[model samples]
Target: MARFLGRRLLVAIPVLFGVVVLVFLILRLIPGDPAQIVLMGTNASPERVAQVRHQMGLDQSWFSQFVIYVGGLLRGDLGYSYISHGTVAAQIGSRLPSTIDLAAAALAVALIVGVPTGIIGGFWPGSIGDKLATGFSVLGLAVPYFWLAQLLILLFAVDLRWLPALGVGGPTALILPALSLGLGFAAIITRILRSALIDVYQQPYIIVARSKGLSNWHVLTRHALRNATSSVTTIIGLQIGNLLAGAVATEVIFGRPGIGNYLVSQIQLKDIPSIQGIVLFIALCYIVINILVDVSHGMLDPRVRKAWAS
Candidate 1:
């Protein structure tokens, strides 16, 4: 396991490097100057603009900027926002917890709803329950996050008066946004798990377990579910990235103060450092989640473990 983890980290280094390069280059390429945007109402002279650019290190060559950025990263610095004159790391740190709370709640919702529905559908393929699950998955996939968020707000907050429609406060405020962001992913989890369970149920080991006079519930819970862990884990890990992406729209619609909301605001303000920092942070998260999934896969599946061992 140590060897496998070491290898995964080694592989992730290059991927993270590439992400940093892409984020830096892409943000630079976007139209509009950060300095100009920052000094929008000041009517600053060209010399003033030049001074701002120089201070912000925008006057430096791209390569030099990249090197400085990389160097700062080595020192755990994500640079300062051009607009706010605050460290990107500090800004992100303040906002990241809200995003994490939203994402974690959404994941919890997805797992609680998706896993059981999927198992049931797998247990009774072609039955009415299975059909219903499949139909729900399709609907979930088709519904846009913003539209769903509004609908949830309308139903629970407006009409039913059961929850608040906007802003973050307590657990109740989290419910609607989490549902809107998570249900779509729940659909994906349902489809993947249902298919994987179906395949696993038909495997020889499952048949052997059944032939040993095991109950259907026992066969499913003990044999089939264990075998299906790898596939389920993979989907869950992949969906984490989707959850983060969806959070952006969901946070905007719901007025949640997550990283997603912070990111959108920064984009509008053309805060290049903040945008780049946020993108890099998200990319790092993705890479780390993938590594965890790989490790979990190896742990859950004997075949994967064997391959890794070799």
Candidate 2:
């Protein structure tokens, strides 16, 4: 397990390096000068702009900038925001918790709702439960996050007055946003887990367990579900990215002060440093989450464990 983890970490290093390089180059390619934007647009005197650019190290060549950016990264610095004139790391740190809270809540909602619905559908593939689950999956996939968020706000916040429509505060504020962000992913989980479980139920081992006089419930709970979880785990892991993406729209719609909204605001201001930092942070999250998923996948399946060990 330790060796497997080390290998996964090693693989992530290059992936993260590529992300860093790509973000740096891509941000530089964006039109309009960050210095000009910082000086309140092109109205600023060229001398003033030059001074700002020099102060920002924008006067340096791209390769030099990249080297400096990377060196700062090595020291855990994300640079300063051109517009806000604050350290990018501090800004992200403040907003990241809210984003993480939203994402975690959404994931919880997804698992709580999706897993059981899938189990029910899988346990009786041809039954009404399966049909209902399928219908739900279709509806979930069909509904867009913005539309759902608005609908939820209208029903729960506007009409019923049971929840807050926008912004984060306590648990009540989280409910609508989490539901809007999570439900679609829940649909995905339901489909994947249902299909996996159905396949597992038809496997020879399942048949053998049943033939040994084991009850349906016993075979399902003790054997079939465990076997099916490997696939479900993979889907769940992959869905983390989707959940974060959804949070972007959801946070905007609901006025939640998460990194997603922060990114949007920075983009509008053409804050290149903040944008680069946020993008790198998000990419790092993806890499780290995937590593965790890979490790968990190995632990869940002996075949995978053996492969990794070898």
Judged by lDDT against the true structure, how good is candidate 2? 0.88
Q: What's the lDDT of the predicted structure labeled candidate 1?
A: 0.88
lDDT, candidates in the order shown: 0.88, 0.88
Q: Against the correct fold, how does model 2 do in TM-score? A: 0.96
Name the runs in model 2 displaced over 4 angstroms.
Answer: 41-43
Candidate 1: worst-modelled 10 consecutive residues by lDDT: 34-43
Pairs of residues at least 3 apart in sequence or in different chains that clash in candidate 2: none
- List the candidates' TM-scores in order: 0.95, 0.96
Clashes of 2: 0
**Candidate 1 residue-wise lDDT, 1-310, digit = tens:** 7888889899999999999899878657767886786677678999988987887678889989889879989898887875777899999999899999999999999999898888888889999999999998899899997899999888999899999988989999999999998898888888888998999988999989889999998998888888886898998888889889989999999999889999999888777778888999999899999999998888889999988887
